[model samples]
Target: MIPQRKLSLLSNRLARKGGRRVPEAVLERDYCLSWFLVGLSKTPLIDILAFKGGTAIKKCYIPDYRFSEDLDFTLRESVPFEKIQAYLALAFENVEKDSGIKIRISRFDQNVLGLTDLPDSGL
Candidate 1:
């Protein structure tokens, strides 16, 4: 659970991106996804995948780049599809078991999106 003080701080920080502050639920989801990604980097996925786009901008380069709900990754080199599959499996399994956040991922060519359930949004 996120402490009230931290949530307020995050919300304040996120408010800088746009004129209005982002909702708490969106920030919570982003925080959850970020935690999942931190665990994901431990798997072989980082060796073959390069974090890119919104996720990178928000988490790496700029913290106030808006809330990114999905994770996007690009292939760093010539890695076999099987290895990539294994990487996803291992990473997701570990994160799910640890966080109880069942992140669903879909891939298209060179991009992958991590889909997650909202705080109270049914389905």
Candidate 2:
């Protein structure tokens, strides 16, 4: 896991470079978003998931694009909701093991998953 202090330092440097404010919360979210996507992709879910949304645009096309607080994906194939939930659970478990970040799914639906970071996670 990237230390919180390191993330703060990086955000500070980016903010200093462009004179644009870099919110620490956004940095934290971005960090989690990246690791979550990586972990998710390693699962079978990758076959069905298609990355999209503002975050994807920012990552693949425009580094300076607006910061996004969440990850968005579209399913390319149909899967039972129960199976999707199971896959998501596996993904979350993988993320925790790999990144040391405890993320709770605060809410979820067919098209959205809202994640919340546990407090004092050491980033």
List model 2 lDDT by residue over 33-79, tens digit each: 98888889889999998889999998879998899987888877768
Cα shift from native, residue 117, model 2 (Å): 36
Q: Model 2: which residue pairs collide?
A: none
Residue pairs with backbone atoms closer than 3 Å in model 1 (clashes): none
**C-alpha positional error of residue 5 in candidate 2 after TM-score superposition, expressed in Å:** 2.9
Give the range where candidate 2 is weakest over 10 consecutive residues by summed lDDT. Answer: 110-119
Candidate 1 lDDT, 26-91, residue by residue in tens: 878887887678778889777777788887898898875767777777776767888877787787
TM-score for each model: 0.66, 0.81
For every candidate structure, what is the RMSD over all alpha carbons to the true structure, in angstroms? Answer: 11.0, 11.4
- Candidate 1 deviates by what RMSD? 11.0
- Candidate that would win on lDDT: 2
